[model samples]
Target: GITLSGGQRQRLAIARALAVDPRILILDDATASVDATTEARIRLGLREAMKGRTTLIIAHRLSTIALADEIVVLDDGRIAARGTHDDLLETSVVYRDIYEHGLLERQFADAVEARGGRQPLEAAS
Candidate 1:
């Protein structure tokens, strides 16, 4: 039996989806399993592949949907806000919270990496 890591499986799934060339693509946290670097590459490829298609991306990571034509922020299964990223950041508390949290996580990860993967004591507490 062959075993694939989560990132590998995600990339495979994305490839399969793109191969079908569907009129619409629904990606739910599609890049969640991959590291930021791999996710960036996938995003670039997806942008090219999705140029003529309608894409519905449900993602908590702001980077995943950064290039979207429209962003619909959902809160508690309801549409809380709808707009571009900047617009939501200004007008939607839900969107701002998500974005800020994600940003902080990335910053923390970066700090850990900068310190050779040593998490700060404060972070561990």
Candidate 2:
């Protein structure tokens, strides 16, 4: 029996493809089911492995998409917007939605950090 999580299957597929040593790799909607941490690690590994090859990554996760040199957004099978991360974030609704969600998560984390270490309130003496 073969069992694999969606992300694992995707990564395995990628590894298998890489083993063939192709000049170009295309990943469509990869990393869709992996946890954030695991996804990040996989993305990092892909980045390293794609050093000189042309890689096409398709993902709904903004963090993954943001790493691309150029981002092409499609709507109804048409190119709605195309540019770098910052450019698309500024001009594309789809990109902006994803990027803003990521930003909000970061802001929440920063806010938690800014609160400093928490401590139990002292009882009346």
Candidate 3:
């Protein structure tokens, strides 16, 4: 038996879920314990697995939710608004606040433009 850290356990759980290859997958804050880089890598791997499969991701992290083709904003167990990221930004105050508060997903495009299209990795090294 191997002792796993919180992030490692989370990754194992995700792998176990995906290994089943179900048509629909549901996640509830699955990556909360992981660092940004690890989360990004997990998202990259999951992206391929998610194709043509229905995924219900219940996440407060905007970066995770932003990848969805459509977003459903839930308020108090009811649907508050549903739309694309751009659409929700215009029409939903709740969804917009998640970004405005700087808790998740910065205005990455503006930051990238400021750096003249160079990636963060390129800028760092």
Candidate 4:
């Protein structure tokens, strides 16, 4: 057995999924262990790997949530709304406000720095 960091473990699991070549895959908070930048890259790759397959992804990160073909916004364990990302943004005021104030952006910037990539932008006043 090997000790793996949270991100590494998550990546390994994804790799395992890809190796098996499943027809339907369900990922619940799959990338939650990784930082935003790494999660972004992994998801970018998954989009192609998961093409034509049924992938039920459950994630809190807006970046991950936005990738879904259809999104269901849940509040207090109840369905508040259901639609595509853009549709929810337009119709659900609560969802829109949450996205605007979410930590996903900041976490993304942190991930970029961790990879020695672009620096995060300064916070708005």
The top-ranked prediction according to TM-score is 1
Better of 1 and 2 by lDDT: 1
lDDT of the candidates, in the order given: 0.91, 0.80, 0.85, 0.83
**In candidate 2, which residue pairs clash?**
none
> TM-score of model 2 relative to the true fold?
0.74
Q: Count the clashes in each prediction.
A: 0, 0, 0, 0
Can you write out model 2's per-residue Cα lDDT over 1-125, one digit (the tens) per residue? 98888878877887898899889988877788776778889888888888899989877777887878899988778988999998997889977877788888767656656656322233435
What's model 4's TM-score? 0.79
lDDT of 4: 0.83
Best candidate according to lDDT: 1
For candidate 2, the lDDT comes to 0.80
- The digit string of per-residue lDDT tens for model 1 on 1-125 reads 99999999999999999899999999989999999999999999999988989999989889999778999988899999999989999999999999999999999999888888898555653
Go through the candidates in order and give the C-alpha RMSD of each one to the true structure.
2.1, 5.8, 6.7, 5.0
Candidate order, TM-score descending? 1, 4, 3, 2
What is the lDDT, from 0 to 100, of the residue 56 in candidate 1? 90
